[model samples]
Target: MKILIVENEIYLAQSIASKLSHFGFVCEMIPSVGEAMQMEAADIILLSANIPGQDFYPLIEKFKDSIVILMIPYVNEEMVMRPLKAGISDYIVKPFMIDELICKIEHYTAFRQLQKEIAFYRDYFCNSLLMPTYSINTKISFPLIIKSVSQKVIDMCVVNYAIHKKLAINFISLYKNHHYKEIFKSVSKTQLTYIIGFETLRKEEKEECVKALKNIPVIFACLGGDLHDFKNVFEINVKEMTHGFQEDVLSVDEYIKTMILKFEDKYPDTELSKRLGMSRKSLWEKRKKYGITKKK
Candidate 1:
């Protein structure tokens, strides 16, 4: 989280910035509102109303959307009311708690998340430049590290999910040591496929992966789907969702993240292992394996 502190008091700004940085916020100390206007972006802005001439007021006109924490010298009515009227997010009286300020940061971040989710639903998803796709219910309710023998399906699932969730996603399951060992045992024979364009890959670096796929077979089958017949591979009953724009493509990792994030949004309470139709521990294992950080 990027934080911008607009304070004329250098010592005070440094103190707050140092504290906020410890709490995982990236702090930028700006000596004045003029400096803040020069910022390209920041997650939160802490502004002080110490000097004269509508202190911090002008910047609010420019950055009303930026989450603003106002520090006013007087705890009186007018000082507080002015910023509130100008759409500040929160207020901190002079000589307040560093702990208290952190609490306010957490509070506002939560509120911002709620607003983000709302806006995401209302505007972002529907307007996404997404490939037409179908859903995957692996039965695991939570995210887990599951390696796919087939890269194409992995790619498809990601794009499908990213389109649904309005988030850029990438699937990094390709570099694993194992193929999610028992996941196929629980697939239950239902194939849920999706349409995707070929952002095809296979550089010399994939020589090892190609060698491994020789043992697994599905990786080759996924890419060629039996028509190429590089080896005597048989076409299985994996589901397919064909669409017109299937030529516009994304990479495999990108597709996978898209799938997972969308899945997360769809089943907010999803126990990825079970709800996603996988082994109970599979989802948890996947998250741990991928180091997929959970969003607060």
Candidate 2:
């Protein structure tokens, strides 16, 4: 990462630059905010607020997006709070150890990385849900069960509901060897927990899961029939063949099979064949090849 040191004290700036450079950081030392502003960009900015007669607020505003750590002689409202409130990442008092400063830099860098990853996943999840048709009723109670033919559809509904309610979900799939009691104990009460793959669990395991999740705020996504024991059971039967945008190109056989299976009942064979750019006989042969027999 690139580090920009904005300090009028040349000796102090060089001292910090040399130590940081040893740790594999690219360092640039500027004697004034004017010089620092002239530089192209930096990952982190170490600004010395003790620079006499220099208004450092402008520097803070210029690099507001960068990790701006103020280096001040003393902590006060004007020196610390003002800059912090104006988006300064952090502040280190003068004569502090290089190790402490580096620790702060690493901490903020990791935090920024986490924020980016969270944003990316949130966007991807929301976009994936756009293709599915589902609804979350506001009156629906927690500790609920969602029984669906498609696990993907259930996932989309539950996740989108959590997102809408501004709740963070701790997802645990029973397909893995996850201890239900241990997971229940570890999950935060303030956050919602989603226990998935309940249909895959054995009768004893399901009983154990119910005991562990009793009276807790959880949403269970089970595949197959309705769960009678659960208080609030929401059934979602999504018949859409396409889950979302396909990342990979489907093979001709796969494409033909999917089209024939999804649209065969909705359209006559001639119309279906026309849509598929093939004759009715060809569609019938393709179906036979794929072992897809129409229901009588």
Candidate 3:
């Protein structure tokens, strides 16, 4: 990482640079804010609070996106808290150990990386959920159950609903999580409680869960079962790519059968067979064996 140390104290600045250089970090030292402003980019900025006549706020603003650590003589509002609002990531007190400073830098680095990754995934899920997979003309209200052959279908429906309503989801997988009552009790009023793996629950557990979810913005997913007790229960069977479960491993034959059944009319036999790594004759034979009739 590239570090820009802005300090008027020449000896201290050189010492910090020398120590950090041992750790494979590229370090640059600027004596004044005027000199620091001439530079374009850096991964981190270590700005000294005691730069007599120089205003360090401009330097902080320039590298606001980078990790800016304020090096202060003492902890006070003027040196620490006030600069934080102006985009200082953290403050390290003068006379601190080098190890402590390195720890702060590493912590902020990991935190910033996590923030970027979260942002990327949020954008990805948001865009992917907006895809028009299954359309329902009837206006479906919340606090319902979706019974589907695969969990993927239920997830799509729930995510689409949450996105449409501009509400966040407090998702809990009942198969993996047993302390669901606590989660349901703690869920925010603004968020929806989306629970999956209803098939894994016992009869009494189901009754208790249903009671707990009453009159709340909730969506329950029951995979490969009939859950008709709910008032707004939707049983959806997608024939094209319907598997018993989302994570079920399909055999070679089963995979071929599913592909042919789903895409036989979409592509010609030659192209489809080539895509599936088989000859047209072999594709026809497999279709016949699987009892899948092709459309005219």
**Strongest candidate by TM-score:** 2
Query: After TM-score superposition, what is the CA distance of residue 239 in candidate 3 from its true location, in Å?
Result: 12
Q: Better model by lDDT, 2 or 3?
A: 2
lDDT of each: 0.55, 0.77, 0.76
lDDT of 1 by residue, 1-296 (tens): 88888888899989988887788888988887766777887778888888545356778777787788888887887878777999999899888888999999889889989998867754543444432333444432222212333444444455455555554433223224234322333222223222221112233323333343333312221332112313332232223334545343546554444444446544543565455566635655555554343444
Error of 3 at 5 (Å): 1.8
Query: Worst 10-residue stretch by lDDT in candidate 3?
Result: 129-138
RMSD vs true structure, all candidates: 16.1, 9.0, 10.0
Q: What are the per-residue Cα lDDT tens digits for candidate 2 across 165-280?
A: 89888887664634445556655566888877565455566667666666677888775432666567887645443356443244576466657656776899989999999998
Q: Please list the residue runs of candidate 3 whose C-alpha ends up more than 4 Å from where it truly belongs after superposition.
A: 21-24, 125-296
Model 2: per-residue Cα lDDT at residue 190: 68
- Model 2 has an lDDT value of 0.77
10 residues in a row with least lDDT, candidate 2: 240-249
Question: What TM-score goes with each of the models?
Answer: 0.43, 0.72, 0.56
Scored against the true structure, residue 81 in model 2 reaches a CA lDDT of 90
